[model samples]
Target: MSVDNFCETISDQINTGILVVSLDFTIVKWNRFLQVHANVTPEKVLGKCIFDVFPELPKKWFERKLSSVIQLGTQSFCSWEQRHHLFELPHTRPITTDSHFMAQNCTFLPITSDNVITHICILIEDATDVCHYQTMLNKTLESLAMANRIDGLTQIFNRKHWEECLAKEFSRARRYNHGLALIMFDLDHFKLLNDTYGHLGGDKVLVETSKTIQSLLRLCDQFGRYGGEEFAIVLPETDLVGAADVAERIRAAIEGTDINFQDQIIRTSVSVGVSIINSQDKRYEDLIQNADNALYKAKSSGRNRVCLSTELP
Candidate 1:
């Protein structure tokens, strides 16, 4: 076979699309792959301006890219991630269900005849499969990360994740010398409710209570499930009085909200403990312990009220 026949055979057999254009953007060579994918014949496109063939093409951007390759004698690459496709080819791949057009990764090579650039060749590869797989993988990773941070029952931040948030908030408050407060609350007589209403009913109560409390908190406040039937709230830039007000509001909201379970209206109450950050406090654990102590007082004094750590005798 002659060298021309060999070159023609290679171009026709290759899966990638190849299109060569001169310095004037006129088509010099149009390979079989380009003919098949672009639905145009070499006879029709040859010697014609590329922009005229594909009027929707980004002419300025394409010109800039071609000029760089011709002037600098360097290749240029375009990934599917940045631009989905240069030419709007039909998405015929069965694997790419979500894609509307063929995703492409294109490379521009400067073709030098005798140490002088004469034409630029564009090589385009179908990247639909790779792009689809990467999108799916990213979504799966995001779902897993969200699941890890969320409590299974209440749909709130899990204890482990909430503790990490508390530590970071503590460090920020200490560094800036800003006011911060912690609130710890638990359902009053949650064990008795579980025994009376069963585990499923108890779950409904917890979910409803969490939603109610969360609705009353500010956007800056972080609320999370501390444990079974217990929750914690971190109030940034809040003093004892502000934290107490928030705790009282949450306590009232929980006490008033009724959870409907098994065709029965179940009423529940919460006892909240409020503690402001102090100079004596060393770590986030200290704030939590103080709030826990106040919560104990609230439970001892009554069942549905808020108590402050400083009030403890």
Candidate 2:
């Protein structure tokens, strides 16, 4: 066997697609992989312009890539990450994967003859599996990050996430003097209620109460589980009076809800404290402290009621 015949045998056996094009984009060579995958024989595509063979291909962008390789006499690359495929070829396993077209990572190789670039060898590799795995990995990471920001039982923002939101809202209020309010509330006599019902029942109560509160909240508002039997709400574009109104609604809503757990009915109430950002408030912690003091007052003066720091002595 001769050297040229030996090279042709190797190219045909390889799984990758190989096609050589001249400066005018005329197809000079097409390997076996390209023939099978593209469903075009060498007799049909050879000596024809690549654009005429693959009309759907990105013409202007591909010209730029080809021109650069020819001028520089260096190899260039086209990743699946940037553009999905160079040729409009069907995937090998379209039934299994989401990709309709074959995911391809292509390389533009400068075929040099005596330092003058004569042809451009385009190598196409199937990247469907790699693309699928990468997509799944990204989604998993997003789910994990989202889980960290949420409370497990209630599915609302956790304490840490809630605080982060508050800090951002507080900064906005300070900068633009936007109306912002914070409400902190805890279930009234939660320990006694837990004693009457099991821990499972308590979980039910928290979940139900959170759902009820969420229904009344705006999309911009942030609600989160503060701790055991406790929850907090940050109301954007709301003032002291507006927050008090919201707090009252929350109190009445909870007082009305009758949670059923294991065929048993459970009634619950909450003591809510509301506070709005004031000029004297230097940090978000100050808003938290004021709301906490008002919450204490609500508990002391009989639970299931709303109190406001602005209204306190």
Candidate 3:
């Protein structure tokens, strides 16, 4: 075979798309890969202007590479991920882990004739798998972050998440002067219950109590297990009266429910203390402390009761 025949055969066999264009950005040659992948037939696309074939190709994109190759006689790469929309395709090439990639990685090399640049050859290779894998990895990481924010035992917002939310709600309340109430409640004699019931019965009470309180809360309220037997509620746009009412409702719900364990009906009750934000209060710490004081007062006075700190003058 002659050298010309071998060169032609090599060009036809290569899987990568090849396109040769002149200084004026007119197509001079289109290879077999280009014909198949780009849905362009050589008979129609050859010797045609780029803008005429694909008018959507921005002027800046063509001007940057075409002018540079003609003037500087330099070779440069054009990744399809960056210049994908230049063509008039309705959908971008879909990338998957198991499928053959359809993206393009092109190199622009100056073609010289008689010591003057006449044309440029653009070589393209597919790189779709890399993009798909990166997208999947990012989604997986986001799912993990969301899972870590939940408490394992109580299935509620963990302490870290609750503190962050508290800080954000505090700032919002301060900014808008909106009513923000914090209620701190704990299971009275929880330690004794855990000790008497061998931790299993105590676990049952905690879980059941959470469900009961959840049913009574409004959509805008946030409830989280602050610690072993203590839980906190954040009520947005609720005044002291509203907070006190909600607390009483939760107390009543828990007091009315009975936990059955091994054919024994065990009564469970919660002591709740509620406090609404006062313009006079200086910090979040004070709000929490006031609620905590009320909770202690409830425990001291009697279990199964709701007390509001804002009632104090």
Candidate 4:
């Protein structure tokens, strides 16, 4: 086989775009891979200057590097990790491919004759698929993160998410010198209710309670089930008085109605503890403990009452 036929055979078998250009950046040859990748046929692109055909090619960038290749006969390679050449392609070509089609790796080799640069060989490898898969993997990880923060039963924020949310709100409140209120509460004799009725009936009460509390809350409020039969609420921009008022409203709502569980009417009440932000408290445990203390006060005084942390005196 002749040398020309061998080169054609090699070009046709390769997946990478292979092309040759003159020292002036005029296309001297374009292989079949280049034709498919570029969507430009040899007849149209041959003998044409690179910028004249793709006018958006960064003139300054190419002028700087191409001048070096021409003058110094330096063979250079560019990785997609550094910059993307996808923008250089026609908009139609980009859209026809999937979102993952942005990998662009190219090598520039200067063919020298007697220490003078005569022609340059360009090789391009398409890595768009690899990049697309990476983006999809990242999105999957994000979804997992969201799922980990949700409670399995009520599909609300779980305890871990509650802590994260409280920390962020605490920072915001301290920065703005605004009020932050925390309410802690538990069902009165939850163990008795669970024992008298089965675990399923207790679950019904918990679910209904979540709904009731959520209805009373604003969009900015954050609530989470603290533990078995216990829950907590974080209210940003609310003072201690405001927190107590909200807690009473919750207690009243719980006691005002009976939850229907398998033909039995279950009556229940909640003991609440309320606190307002006075200083920059970093950990949620301290605020939770304070609320628990107030809740203990309410439980001791009367199971259905609301107690405030500041009302300890």
List runs of model 3 lying over 4 Å from the truth: 1-127, 258-266
Give model 1's TM-score versus the native structure. Answer: 0.92
Per-residue lDDT of model 1, residues 68-92, tens digit only: 9998999999999999999888666
- Encode model 3's per-residue lDDT on 256-307: one tens digit a residue: 9998876767787889999888888787777888899999889999889988
Q: Show where candidate 1 strays beyond 4 Å.
A: 94-96, 311-313
- The TM-score values for the models, in the order shown, are 0.92, 0.90, 0.66, 0.68
Write down the worst ten-residue block by lDDT for model 2: 304-313
Global CA lDDT of candidate 3, please? 0.80
Whole-model lDDT, candidate 4? 0.81
lDDT of 1 at 46: 99
**For this target, which candidate reaches the highest TM-score against the unseen true structure?**
1
What's the CA RMSD of model 3 in angstroms?
Answer: 5.9
Evaluation by TM-score, superior candidate among 3 and 4: 4
Report the number of the highest-lDDT candidate: 2
Per-residue accuracy of model 2 over 118-208 as CA lDDT, tens digit each: 9999999999888878888889999999999999999999999999999999999899989899999999988988888978888889999
- TM-score for candidate 3: 0.66
